[model samples]
Target: MANQTEVLRLLMANAPEYCSGDRLADELNISRTAIWKMVQGLQTAGYSIESRHGRGYRYVENNQLSVAGIQNGLDITPAVQLIVLPSVDSTNAYLKRMATRTPLTEPVVVVADSQTAGYGRSGRTFYSPGETGIYLSIGLPVTTDQPLDAGLLTTSTAVVVAQTLRQLFDVPVELKWVNDVLVNHHKVVGIMSEGITNLETGQISTVVVGIGINLTTAAFPSPLQSKAGAVLAHPTKVTRNQVIRQLLRTFFERYPSYRSGDFMPLYRQLSMVINQRVSLKSGARTYDGVVLDIAQTGALVVQLTDGRVQEFSSGEITKVNLLTGQYHG
Candidate 1:
């Protein structure tokens, strides 16, 4: 009998059209009864596989995440590696452990369907649940002795994600200060970047950037019910596999020149905090200010209430009057 992933691949290749039972059996070198059993199994696994007595099977395309499916759609190089897991503690943690054992000169992309212990900046647990999200992490190894800018890595990845979502879904995607992607005025994606230091060399070798997106997630915990949102609320856009493919393709295509500040123009255009009334909380103090601009160096330029203009490369955004969203008060 044909496996689930292969069945999905062939069905997706002939999406919206029925592939005859004889054809499926012939390609997989199985019997018609085997194909029928496989189709039934797929239908039970939350996939929409429609079949008729005379006609064959049609895929409605709300697919579960599979490495085979994702890799089949990627336009990536031979050096890039891809991995997909059903459940993991965290994609970033998994890659960090792998980086210690594996030689990583090229790119390695690891994605989990859900994370039981996912985390973002400041060590906050990202609410990752199954059947509705994509948690991805990429390992970028240091090819040369050049140092990497942690800030640019995060900000640049944020711009790449926002750009990909806009191009694919045609939605009003925006970026919050630092590392958050907003959709429909709510946070739909959370990004975190970490530099992995080699224990032997005492130098940072690999940079792990994790991206978590709420894709068709309809419910969240009570505390996050209002703050979390989904990229595609309905099955209107493309599949999750396609989303991952596009994000990977776009990010790598610009990786060579991202640090050159060429992405700043698009970053500035997608910013949600620029020129907005904002409140910055640095340590125990909270100061109110209005954002001026996103500097080329990735620093946040703010004009505070005391009339002292300041530029902050790092701070806590306790509150901000987002034009797309209402104030906390």
Candidate 2:
């Protein structure tokens, strides 16, 4: 399969003005019929190709994103390892199983080409199309001596993802508070963190940060199509592999700050909720308030209408009824 992909890649790299069938066959040492079949296979693999009757084949000029390139581009420490799988139910679930067996010093990454049962918060179905996006999970072991605040971890991870995107692509990236990345007010990336802490020792044993991103999107379900977008949907062109490598590198660089308890200052630099109006909801309770600041512990400080301030932890957030600005009561 690798050899076949190499041949296809070579053909694509030399295409766009048409690589004659005879020339492609000679170059790949395969027959013209075999070359034809390979072209059809590439098309079926979500690659766009243009064929002309007498002119042979031409590639539509895509970024040719793949797992191999992503692995090569990642700049993680020796403790981190990359695992690429052909298919899986979910990257997060796979990492959870491996974390139990792998040593704390060794961090493992699980990446899937396709997902069978992708999910989100509250059991929401996450649409994970094969070979068209990025799905990955990272395994990290927090020290037994220092247990991180849950809210701080979430906000720090969010900042890491946003900064990575800024480094990799020329697109605008925004933080959706807790852990989501948006481009032009449309969600392009979702971050979910799961960890197991030893209550007796006050330490986090294992932490898994799962990331999902849309790289090249043609369409999505109508329900969320308008509210979500792909990185490529912006004016700039971005490949999945490029984004993945940058994300891993940025996370490692920021992990030290988080571990040293110096993340509060850095978190404030990237936070988006300071002095903004936001709607907060927890279970059956909901209220509107002006976002004053995000505390070092990761709670959002909001001043209510009655001149009182309230702090909220993890919850559903919105911008209130008005589409233009803040949701202050």
lDDT of 2: 0.72
Off by over 4 Å in 1: 1-11, 14-60, 232-237, 282-287, 322-329
TM-score of 2: 0.72
lDDT of 1 by residue, 45-76 (tens): 77788987788998876657777567765776
User: What is the Å distance of residue 35 in model 1 from its true position?
Assistant: 5.8
Model 2: residue 312 alpha-carbon error in angstroms: 1.8
Q: What is the lDDT of residue 75 in candidate 2?
A: 57
71-166, model 2: which lDDT tens digit per residue? 544656655777777789999888887766663566778888778877777787777887677888888777646565566766788778778777
The top-ranked prediction according to lDDT is 1
- Residue 127 shift from truth in candidate 2, angstroms: 1.6
Top TM-score prediction, candidate number: 1
Query: TM-score, each model?
Result: 0.85, 0.72
Q: On a 0 to 1 TM-score scale, where does candidate 1 land against the true structure?
A: 0.85
